[model samples]
Target: MQSPPATAPVAAPPERGTSPRRAAPRLVGWLAAAWLGPLLAYALGVAGVLPVVVLGLTAALLRGGRTLLDRLVLAGALLLGAACAAGLLFSAWPWGLHPVPVAGTALTVLLGVAAATGRRPRLPRPVPADLLPVAAALVAAGALAWPYLRAGDLAGRLAYAMTGEDNSRHLATVEGIRAVGGYLFADPSAAARIAPEGMVWYPQGFHLTAALLDGFLRSSTAPAGPASTLDHYLGWSLGAWGLLVLAVTWAANRLAGPRLDLPRAAALTGALTAACLGSELARFVVYGYPGESLGLAATVLLVALACRPVARTGTQLAVVGALCVAVGFAYLMFLPVVAVLVLAWLVRDRRRLRRRPAVLAVVALLTAVLAPLPAVAGLLRTDQVDNVATGGGVFPRYDAFLALAGLVAAGLFAGGLRLPVWRRYAGALAAALAFAGGFLVYFRALGTDPRYYYGKTLHLLLAVLLVGAGAVTLLLPAPGRAAQSRPRAARPHDRAAESRPRAARPHDRAAESRPRAARLRWRTPRPARALAAAAVVLACAGLAGLPRGTGIFAQPFDGRTMTWAAAWWSGTQARPGPAELAVRALAQAPAEAGVVTVVVSDRRREGYLATLFVATLQGTHGASGPAVYRLPLSEPARSAALVERVPGRIRFVAADPAAAGIVEALLAAHPDLAGRVTLQRLR
Candidate 1:
C-alpha cells in the first residue's frame, strides 16, 4: 500500500478536489481486501465451497497492487469465471462426473500455472483514513435488506418472496447441478424438468455459486429438510440484491477519489441509496431473478474497474479479460454493455496499450480461454431471446425522462474532460452514453417491449450518474475552509502544474482561483460555494426519483413487504397447509439420514411447490414423487404401489391421514420396503 515515491518534494498539500493516484483510500482498501480475503478463504473452505476459494487465490497470484475493492472484484470475477468455463467445458460429460472433482482438477492446473509465473500477490497498504464511507455503505445496504433478514429463521426469511415459478425453476437448476455432478445440460433428463426448453445453454454462473452454497449448507446445517432447500435459494436471492447496492456504493466511493471527508462519505451513501431505491432494478429480488441481480452487480463492478488505470502488462490484461468472461457467465445480456466499457478502457489508454500489441493479444486469448463459447453461441438459438427481442410492448413509461436525466448527468462528466484526470472517468462516461444509445437502438430495431429486458440497463446507467453525485463532494472545498480562506487572483497557466500528475498537483494558494472564464471570482463567499455543492448532491438524488416505479419505496418498507412472505412460511398459521405438513414432517427426519426421497400425496395444489422443495432437499433432482407430475396425486395406495416397484430410490411416502394407513398397509407386505418405507401422515 505504499504510495509510489514522490517525484519531487512539495511544500503544499495535495489538491482537495483532484483524483487520487490510487482508486480508493489506502486504509479502507487494506481493510476490505488484505484483512478480509483470508477470512473469506477460510470460511469458504470450512463450508465446502472450495473451488471458488481456490480459483480466487489463483487469480490473486497473477497480480496485485490494485485498490482493495478492485483486487477483491478481480478475484471474485476469476472465481466465477473459472467455475463457469469449467462448467461448460465438462458440461457434456457423463452423469457420474461430479462438479467438485472436475472443478478441483481444472483449478489445480490453473493454480500451478499461476504459481509458475512467480508473481507473488501483494496488496498495497495505502495510508490510513477513516472508514466512514465504507461503514455507511454497509449500513445502508443492511437497511435495504430488511425484508429478507427481518424474519427470525430460514423458513420465515423465505416468506417475503413474491414469485414461486422462477424460484422453483432456479432451485431445480441448482439441484440439477448436484444431481448430474456437473452442469445440468450434461443430463437433459434432469435438466429438462427445470426449465420449459431444457437448460442446455443457460448461463450457470448464478446457479454454480448457488449449488456450491447449497452444498455447504447441506453439509453443515442440521436437517431442516425441505425448508432448508428453500432457505438456500432465498438466502442467495436476497444476497444478490444486497450485493448490487454495495457494488454501486463502492463504485461511487472509488470515483469520488481517495481522501474522503465526512460530508463526502455521507453524500456517497445517500446518493447511492436513494438512486437504488428509486430505480426499477430494485424490484429484481421480488421479481424472482437473482441471477440477473448478481449479473448486474458483476456488470457494475466490471465498469468500475475499467474506470481505473491498468498497467500495460500481460498479466493485468489477462485478469481483466477473465472479468469480461465472468460477466457473460453472470448474465449474457449484459456482456454487450461490459464490452463497450472494455473498449473504452482500451481507448482511454490507447497510447500505452498500442505500445504493446502482444499485451492486447494476451487479453483476447485469456478471455476466449475463460469464455463459455457454446453457451454464447446458443444465445441466438434460445426462444427466450427471441421472445425478448420480438415480443410486444411500447417504450417504458419513464424512458424519455430517464434519457434526459442521463444526459444532464453526462454534463457532470463533461466538466471532468478539462482536467488531465479525465482518463480515469472516461469509462463511466462511455457507459452512460452506451446505455442511452442502446436504449434508442433497441426501441427502434428490436421488440416493442424492449423495456422487458433492456430496462435493467437503466440501473447500470443510474449507478454511473450517481457516481457523479458522489464525486461532487470530493470536488467542493469544505465549508470551514471556504469561510476563512480568500481565493487568490487567477494566475497564468503554470508549466509546472501541467507537468505534474493530477494527484500530485500541489494546492497553490497564489494560484487558487477558477479558470480564466470565471464568473465566480475568488471573492465569492466560500460558505455559499460549499452550500451550493451540497445542493447539487441533493439535486442529483432527487433527479433519480424522476424515473421512479410504482413500488419504488415499498421495497425497503418492512410492514408492506412482510405480508408477501406468509405463503412461503409453513409454521404457526391458523390452518396448517399441505406444504407446511410436508416440510414439518421432513424436518423431523434425522440429520444423519442419507438423502431420502418422499412422494408427496397432497390433494391440494400446494403439493406442486412442496414437490420442488422436496425434490431439492432429497437431492433427487426433480425426480421425487412415485410418478412425476405437475402436482402430487391424492391416492396414497396407488403411489405406494408405484413406490413398491422403485424401492431403491423412493424411500418415504408423505400422505394425508385419510390415505396414510392404506399406503402403509400396502407397503408392509413388500420385502424390499418392509421396514425401510415410512409413511409420514399429515392430518
Candidate 2:
C-alpha cells in the first residue's frame, strides 16, 4: 500500500481549446460513468445508490481526481441535476409506469454506446485515507437513527420516530404516484385528498424516487403482503440524513485542505460530522420533512460545488442544471436558496463571467424570467400564501443568539483573508447571509412572523458558518513551511542541500534582514496563531457537544412518536389492530365491491393513518377524492346519509364504540348498504 501524500493529487485539468471531436468522447464518458454507476448499483441490489451515483458521477464529470473531498462537494450540483433530468424524463409514457426497469435498460444502452464510441472514463483511484470521512459519516447517521432502531419489536422499529404530521401526507402522495405509475398529474384521482383541486404542480422528484424504490423493493422481496408505509418512510428519510452528513464532512475537509494531513483530515471529518448531526438541523427529520431533507442535501452539495470555481466543461454545467431541476422537484423552497449561491458564485467568478459574456447574459435573462415561476405554479396555493406568510416564529428566543453567532463567524471568516482561498469561504458565507437577510426582510415587509419560514435556513447557515470557522486552521503554519523556518545547523551529510541553489533570493534575503517587530505585519506571531487554532478547535467541540448538552438527541425517544401515526392504529403485539388484516381482506374484495372507500370515524385525529396505510397497502384507497372522509358519526341519520352518498360499491368503515352502533344501525336499515359496507370496530 502506498502512503498518501501531504496533499491528495488531482486529475489533470481538462485540456483547454480541445476540438468538438475530442470533447465528444469525454462528454460521452461523463454520461456513461454517471448513469452506469447508479443503474448497475441498483441492479446489484444495492440500497442508497442514488446519492452514491450522484457523488461518483459528479467526480467523474468534474474530472475531480483522486482527492475524495472534491467529489463530495461537487456531488451537490450533480445530485439535483441528474435526479431532476432523469425524473422528468421518467415522468414520460411507459418509463413512468416502469421506472426501475426502464432506467436500467436505458442506462445500459447508453453505457454500451459510450463504450463503443468514446474513451473509457479515467476514474480516480480510492486511497485508504478516503474511507475515513465515509466512516465518520456512517457513525453520525447511526447515532441519529439509534432511537428508532432501539425498539424491541419489529413494529416499533419501523415506526417513524418523528411526530411530524407531514409524513402521512407525504406517504399518501408517494403512494398515489406509485399506484398511478407516474407523476400525480398523470392521474390526480390516485392521489386522493392529498392533491387538492387547482393545486396544479407539486415537486415529485423525491416522491417519484421513493415510489420507484417501493416498486423495486416489492418486486425484489416477493413479500406475502403489501409493503409497510412506516418502513419506506423510515428508510428514505434516514437515507437522506446519511447523505447530508457524508457531504458535510467531505466538504468541510476539502475546504480546509492542502495543509491537512491524513490524521488531521480524519479528525476534521469526525468533528464536523458530529457537529452536523448535533446541530438544530437534525430536527428536520424529527419534523418528518423528507422532501426538505433530500433537497437540503442537494443544497449543501450545490454550495460546495459553488465554493470552488465553475465547472470546466459544458457537460458538467448541464449536469448542474439538471441537479437544480431535481432540487425544485424535491423541495421548491430551496431553489431560491440555490439561486442565491449561484449569484454569489457568478460574482466571485466575475472574470470567468466576463470572458463568457453570452453565458452571463443568458443566465441573467433566465433569472429574471424564472424568478416568479414559483408564485405562479408552486405547491403553495394563492390562499395558502397568507397562511404561510402570517405564520408565527419557530424559535423566537434563539434569534439574538443566532445573529450574534453569525457575526462572530463572519469575523472569523475575515481572519483568513490573507489566503486567496479565503474568498471561497467568503462567497459561501455571503450567500448564506444574503439568503437569511433577504428572507427576513421579506417576512418583515409582509408584517408577519420572521422566524417561521425563515427558520428553515438555520441549518444551512450553521453548516456554512462552522465550515468557514474551521478554515481558521489555515492560520497555522504548514508542516513543511514550519520545518523550513527553523534554523538548521550545518552537517557533514548535507551534500544534497549544497547541490541545490545556495544563493538566497532577494525576497528571502529581505525577509531575513527585517527586524522581528517589523516582520509582524507579514508574519503572524507563532503563539497567537496557535491560540487562534486552539480556539477554533474548542468552538467546534462545543458545537459537537450541543445535542448531548441540550438533550436534543433524546427527543425522538421521548416524544409522541409514530409510524405515519400507525403505532396507535397497529396496536401492540399482544393486541394486533385491524389495519393489516383489513388491508389484506380489502385486497381480496370482489369486483362487485367497486372502488373502495375507507371511512374512519375520527377524521381529524386518525384520518391520515387510514389514508397512508390504505394508499400504501391497497393502492389508491381513497373514496372519490380524499383518501378517507370523516363524518360526524355522533349523528346517526346524517352520518348514515353521508356514508350512503359515498360513490363506491365497497366501504371499509372504522368506527369507535360511540359510532359502531350507528354504523350497525345504518347497515340494518339498508340491506344494500350492509352488503356494500365492511365495518371494523375500534376499541
Candidate 3:
C-alpha cells in the first residue's frame, strides 16, 4: 500500500493520479471520513442544519474527479459553506422561516436534483490508517474542551461559569433570528410596534445555525434546562465550535498530502494540531466570539480547498465559492485570509490556474473586497463599519504577540529557502502581510477593538507551522520507487576501475575520509524529522494552553473575570447578569402587550435585549437600541420620538435620570399618556 513520497524531483506516474471516473468513489469515502468526527460530536447539537451541510457536500461530489485528499478537504469546505449559506438565506426570512426547516427543505430539493444527475457519490471505505488521524483530532478537540464539558446542563456552564459579553449577545442574536423567522435587518424586538427603518443583513450563518441547533436540542427527549435562551447559546457555541479540532487536523492533512506514510502523517498531524490549538482560540471561546472562532476553522478548510493542483473542475470551483461565502458569512474580517490563499494558489500554477478556477478565485476576492462597503456588504448586518468604534485605542495588547509571530514567520521564510515544499509557505507569507497591513491600516482607520485581531492571526500562525511541516516532509528523503527509483549512471572512475592507481581506488579508506561537495549538509534523518515534529507539538501545545491557563497577557481569571463570565449579557451589573435582569424585567412587563421599553445606562449592555429580542421574547414592543441605553431623555419630544416610541403605557426599567427622561419624553410625545408611564427598579 506504499505510495510515492510528496517531495523530491520525482513525478508521480500517470497511472498514480486518480482519474475522474474514480473520483466519485473517493469523494464519497473522503466526505464520510472527514465528517465522521463532526457528525458524532454534533449529532444532536444541530440536527436541523446537518442535512444542509450534507447536501452541500453531495453537490460538491457531483462536481467530482479529484484525488481522495482533495475530495475530502473540498467536501468539508462545501459542507460548512452550504450550511452557513443556507442559514444566511433563511435568516433573511420572517421569524416563522427558521433556518432548520428552511434549510432542511432546501437540502431535500438539492438531494433530489443530485440523485437525478446520476453522479451520486459512494462513500469510500476508510482504512484503519485513515481512522488514526480522525481519532487524533477528536482526541485533541476533547482535551481542549475538557473544561466546558463539565457535569451539568449547558446553562450552568454558560451562565455562572461562562465569561465575556459576546456569548450572550450572540445568544440574543440567535434568539432574535429565531423570533423574527429571518434577519429583518431591524432589531429583533421591533416585532411589536415598528422596528427601526435600519435594514440589517448581518451574516446569520453562525447565529442562525446555533438557533436551529438549540431548538433541536430543546425539543429532544432529553432533560430540559432552566431557560431556553441559555440552551440556545450553548447549542450555538458547540454547533459552530464542536468540530474545530477535526477541521484543523483535516487542514494539516491537506497540507501534508496523502502520499505520507502513516508515521510521517501522524507526526505532521501532531505538529499541525499543536500549531492550530493556539491560545487565541481559547480566548475566542472564553471571550465569546463564536463567529470569529467558526471563521478561523472554516478558513483553514478553505485554504485546503484552494491549495489543490490546477485542473480543478467547475464543480470543484463551485464548492470553493460556497465555502468562501460561508467564511465570509461566518467572519468577513478573515475573508482576506482565504482570498489570499486562492490568489496564491492561482499564482503558483500560472499556467493551469490562469484558465481554471481563476474566475472563481476572482469572484472570491471580490466578495471579500466588497464586504466592507455598505452598498454591497449589507449581508454582513452589524459587522459593518458602523459597528466598529469610530475612535478608541490604537494597538491592542496582542499586537506584541502578532509582531513576534511575524518575525518568526519571516525567519522561517528566509531559512527554509532550499526545501522542495518552500512554495507552500506562500500562505504564511501572504497571511503575515495581511496581518501587518490590517494592523497598520484597517484597525488604525477603524479604531482598535481587542476582539478584532484576536482570532485573525490564529490561522496565520498555524499556516506558518503547516508550511514548515510541508518543507520537512518534502526535504526529508522517503524511500520509494519514485524517490530513489531512478538509478544514476556509473561514475567515470567506476568504469575505469582497473586504470586507477592503488591510492585512488574506490574502495580505499582515504577516499571515504576526503571531503566531498555532495555532503555539504546532512539530510534530515527520519528520527530527526520525528523529533522536530514532536518539538513543534510540544511548543504549540504549551502555547495552546496559554489563553486558557497563563497566557501571554497573564491576566488571571480573578473574581472580576468570573463576574464578566457570569455576566454574559450584563458585564458587571447585578448578581445573575444583565440578560437575566433584562429577561426578568420584561417578564414583569404588562402582559397586555403594549410598548414596554427597557433601559440600562451602565456598561451592562442589557438594554439591547429590549431593543433586540425582548419584544419577541416577552410578547411586547421594544423601540430602543443599545446606544439609547445611555441616552438621556432630557428633551421630551426628541426623546419620545427617538426611543420611547410607545404612545401610551411606556414601561420604564431603569433607575437613572435617563430612565426618568424617557418617561418625561413619553408623557410629552403622547399628552394623553401623562399618567400611563411607569418605572421599575432591579436590585
How well is each residue in 1-683 modelled by candidate 3, as lDDT tens digits? 66333321122332325566786686566545444533453454554445446555563434332233334545656656655555545645553443344444554555444544534443332333455456655664554444456524432343332345455456556655556655545344443232232324555567656655555454331323225555456545744554565566665554444235455666667655554444344445555667866776676666554543323344546665666776676677666566677667656655644565566666556445433332245744454555443433333335535644554455335433432223455554567556655555665564555344433554455444444444354444342332222322211111122244655432222223545433223346667756865776666555544323332323323343321122222223322344454555544553454444655433333454333344433323224333233454333433455444444555566635665655655557567655766666644
lDDT of every model, 2 decimals: 0.52, 0.52, 0.48
Global local distance difference test of model 1: 0.52
Clashes of 3: 16
Shift in Å, residue 525, candidate 1 = 17
Candidate 2: pairs in clash? 76-301, 80-323, 81-322, 81-323, 193-626
Q: Each candidate: how many clashes?
A: 7, 5, 16
Question: Which candidate's TM-score is highest?
Answer: 2
TM-score of 2: 0.70
Task: Evaluate candidate 1 by giving its C-alpha RMSD to the native, one decimal.
Answer: 10.0
Range of the 10 consecutive residues with the lowest summed lDDT in candidate 3: 487-496
Assess every candidate by TM-score: 0.65, 0.70, 0.63
TM-score of model number 1: 0.65
Q: Could you tell me which residue pairs clash in candidate 1?
A: 1-124, 1-125, 1-126, 99-181, 159-565, 160-565, 393-448
Q: Weakest 10 consecutive residues, lDDT, candidate 1?
A: 486-495
TM-score leaderboard ranking:
2, 1, 3
